[model samples]
Target: MTNTALTALREPAFPDAVITEAIRWTEQNGPLDDAQALRLAASRTADAHEGITQRALLLGERIGLQPELARARQWAPWVLLGLAALIVIAGLGLAGNVVGGGERHINVIVALASLLGLHALTLLMWLLGLLLPLGSVNTASLGWIWLSLTARVAGGKRGQAPVLVRAATGLLSRAKLLPWAFGLVSHGIWSLSFTVVLAAMLFALAFRSYTLSWETTILDPEFFVRAVQALGWAPAKLGFPVPDAATVMAATPATPGAAGQRTWALWLTGCIAVYGLLPRLLLVLLSAAVLRSRRKALQPEWQEPYYRKLAARFTALAPASIVDADPGRLRGAMPASLPASQLHDTLFVIGFELPPDMPWPPAGLPAEFAAHAQRIDGSAPARRALLDQLAQARPRTVMVVCHAVSSPDRGTERFLREVLMHCGECRLWLAGAPDAGATQRWLDWLRDTGLERITASDRPDIAP
Candidate 1:
């Protein structure tokens, strides 16, 4: 075929080897005359081009671009963490006001802070659950807890909850979920529990009071009494039935006296517990939740299926002759009639008979066959010498067949690929399937590497 016409029929995505093989076949077998061969090659090229184009279109339709929105959903955890931080900051400001004078301001601040902090912590726990090792204390216990809560809150199907839990656990075991799952579970448990405890303690301290006693006072009784009076507590002398200093302090800690000072210490302790412990817990949870959600969303669903399909499809298309190669012996015993014409053409077929009880050698039959066939047991070194000879001789084709031999090995395949690459004019056809998938895979490998002229015979007989 004219190169221009053949080029027009080529599919852009089809590997170059397929096109090369089609062209070679058409040139050799299409017709008796040059004109007819050219015409036939053009038609075959068109058919091949159409087949590849259709396959490409089908692949595109089956697998569309992954949705961007799904990607964003996976990253939602980061946003939640930011919001949690904002809530904690506002809570701190409100806490300051409450401690200064307004009880209402302080109460509002603490409540908001606790709520935000808890959510953030939960998020962190969820993220941790996605990462880390499965069956570890953190992965097994904490991962289960957060996922269970997530399942409940999300209203995921009851059946699915168990499946998701199992998947989450597997994520840890298989190293699929990773550091994300571990983070989520760890943060969630620690933050939630801490927040609840802190809130309870703070509520108790805000509404209660305490008292103190002194061993002696050098100042006049009225001095102490006036001090208590300023704090809105009525102080009485020790000589008469007096309002207990402890009770007065409890009633009004803000009063300007020793009792009020004691109240301030208790309040300060409560504030420190809430601000320091609560915010840290919230940050952990929120970070965890965000990470877990994002990891789940970003995970590629097509990864396993795609590779599985590729392997299966390649196996299915494997040349039949190779699959049927006998395990006990090479194809039928060597044919009796050795064609001299075949040998003269630089492309030939030779067959040999072997003893039935032959014990297979460790290096394989090909090494031994080389010695018997050519009077030279061209192992690796000899094989390389043959490739060098072939590159210089530049024969059109070479076909060798050895009986009672196992399939070719990596050395044989590598030799063939090198020969094909070096001697562009020569075509090599390797027949005999010693392994189920080995030959086709090697052929594909050659094709991928641009050695398209090499072909494997699928036919049952050799009549040449």
Candidate 2:
């Protein structure tokens, strides 16, 4: 992964990558020790904005696992919330209004049962998932997937997509941003939806009154009286009053009075607030706390060779080599363009983690390009390791093949600079048939870097 691609996939909420933890650690601990500083020059720098007379620091470059998608995912909760709110209002309106008949009355039993029962069923599902460890019962995961899909579909076309949508698409495309971004967005959206439901219920009940009664040809009146008493026990304790047995058993048509209806309404509303909304809000809070606590030991994954090599690479740089760069300002950009085909017949072809559709090491490539062209894959450490391998190969004139349509962003630019810095006399080859805009940017970037060798070549099927 190019250092630029590292920043490409960022989701700040979750603690996913090791480099993320390292940066967090460094931010808290100040600069690296001089011994480590001498080794990792990129980590240390005088604050570019603070002025040149500042202390040098050794901060490892951390990549955002879901960089592009961060902004897009931010819009998910609000959109889903709006949809959920409309559903809730429409549902309550329907629930409160009874149709037909001379004596107008709602089956309080059905209304209460449906509202409270749905929440109860949901909680039961969650409880089952927790106790049994069944992955399929994971409501949170399902919710996250739904939220992401909703964001993508209702989010508009990719080319005209909002910046946030672009961010989400970029990060999600790589699968790097999933673990962190999905969890937070799903839980938040779910919580917001429930909150709106509760608000709608409260507002609907406050101004209006509905006669609530239960009727059953098979069940006795005493049965419902006992059921209401039992159901309202907890709710009553929590300050919402429960109707007495006479009221519970009273058929509104025969008993023609508005007795105990308000208490019943308050009890149902409170049941939702206490049992439904409260639990959800609590879960959201707990998830937030869990997200924060995970950052406690923010360190890179030692087992991954990428992080280890990256650490060593940083530590190896001299203090004087430290460049004052800003992560926020350095987003390398190039518009995605047309697809390019297999690359061969070039002096050297070094691929930097192209998407899966374009197979690596083009089939039947000419021997020279095949020999030098390296398909570098995996994490930052793995790419750096490949760079080391490329340096050893020492091919004098190498052409780095990139997904031209993917465009030459800051990450691409940085990758070229790093490859040039190490491999020498490197040129960017736009593999596939990228449009003129993307091709021109790549050429312009090469010229800006003083490679002087700027040309657009669209020889598809260089397999010969």
Candidate 3:
């Protein structure tokens, strides 16, 4: 078989023994038939595909890559842009009024009202994004809650129900998207409602100028007649009316044309204000309703005590105490009672007693315990036996100090997995140097096997 094929067969999904037998069978037969080769390739491919698919599924569920939530992310930007447009229009109106020369500049009340309306509209869009299920979006909706409830009910039942329920519950419980969705909808609704009310107030203010009017020069017929008479007289004497005369005529009382122009301007301004506020008002109201419904559906209850009890029970499985050891203390603190054989058993920690031959550190030892130690590779059968003995001597929780190996092999991962399987109910914490990439891969493997990595860090408190 090609190296690639050989590598594929070596994956954990395929039994090593089975691959070895197949290879041996092929080699001894020498020049297999086409059918035989095809069978071998197919078997390897099946194993590889299964492994990849299983890993992908576990990872996806862990990260809450639900269909609904994915859709939400896609449309979030568009909603934000709509909100921005409302603000831009309101700002332009305010700027235009501020810059234009008039007896009254832009009404501060109207400008403020328009701004409030825009804010309301923006709020509404945010709410819609949160509450309405975007089609095909991978959202962690009520599905997670149902799965968790089912798990609790079926946990101890016979057959596949318990297993299936537990699997579903774990996926839903760990996923973050559901909680995030709740928070977003809650906050968005509140914000949008406030904005909507503000927009309405602003719209009312923008219409105030149109609703209330006062007499002006433009509204006076006498000013119009006199102004026109002067213009007619001026055209004969000069090409343009004199500056002083023009100023006097311009200030003359309003005519029907001037009154009509003023009325139109007032009406247009009022329309602009109302039009700008309406969409935002609608959006805000829609968002508020969605938020209210979601809140009702997801009302929080009192469950703290129950969760605390569960946490306490889980932590009870850990061993009572462990000796604190760091990289420097490895060699001297090796436990003496450990047997040299069986170190290869994997997941065994050999703790050595401080030997007289070992050198002491410059600082004096503390009153709490005897000398410190280091971790040794327990993969060797002899070393594993020694470590196993020490583990048995102490309470299962006794921490062993060990020297950090320069290059711990991949077998360490196998050993950790074996330890977890053997202990079953016991929680395992592995302390080691910083190596985020390797740690993540090991953790992912553990997760796939229905186990969790309690902690993996280089901090002194966590160091073994």
Please tell me which predicted candidate would have the highest lDDT against the true structure: 2
Write one digit per residue (lDDT tens) for candidate 1, span 1-464.
11211122123322222222222233233322323332333334333234332332333223321121122223334433443354445554444344444332123224434434554555555445444332443544433444455444443343223333343344334434344444443444444444544455456545744222221236554544444334222111211123345533343324424434344334333343444454545545554554444443322221232222222222222222332223443322211121233222343222212223433221222332233233124244455345445434443444433321344443344334434432223323333446646556555544443444555443213223
lDDT of 2 by residue, 1-464 (tens): 11111222233432233223334343343534444433334444432211111112122222222332343446545555564565466545544443222344657677666665655675566556545645455534534455445546554455213333333333342333333333344345445555666676666666655566667878878888887778778878788888897677664556657587777777667766677666766665554454454433332333232233333344223233322233433323332211122122235677765778887775535566675566765355665566565444444556677777765554555455555534334555566754777777666655554444423344423322
Ranking by lDDT: 2, 1, 3
**Model 2 quality (TM-score):** 0.46
Q: Which ranking of candidates, highest TM-score first?
A: 2, 1, 3
Summed backbone clashes in each candidate are 40, 38, 53
Worst 10 residues of 1 by lDDT: 1-10
Cα lDDT computed for each candidate against the true fold: 0.36, 0.49, 0.33
After superposition of all CA atoms, the RMSD between model 3 and the true structure is 22.1
Which ranges in model 3 have alpha carbons more than 4 Å from their true place? 1-65, 68-464
Cα error of candidate 1 at position 461, Å: 24
Candidate with best TM-score: 2
Model 2 is weakest, by summed lDDT over 10 consecutive residues, at 48-57
User: After superposition on all CA atoms, what RMSD does each candidate show versus the true structure?
Assistant: 21.6, 18.4, 22.1
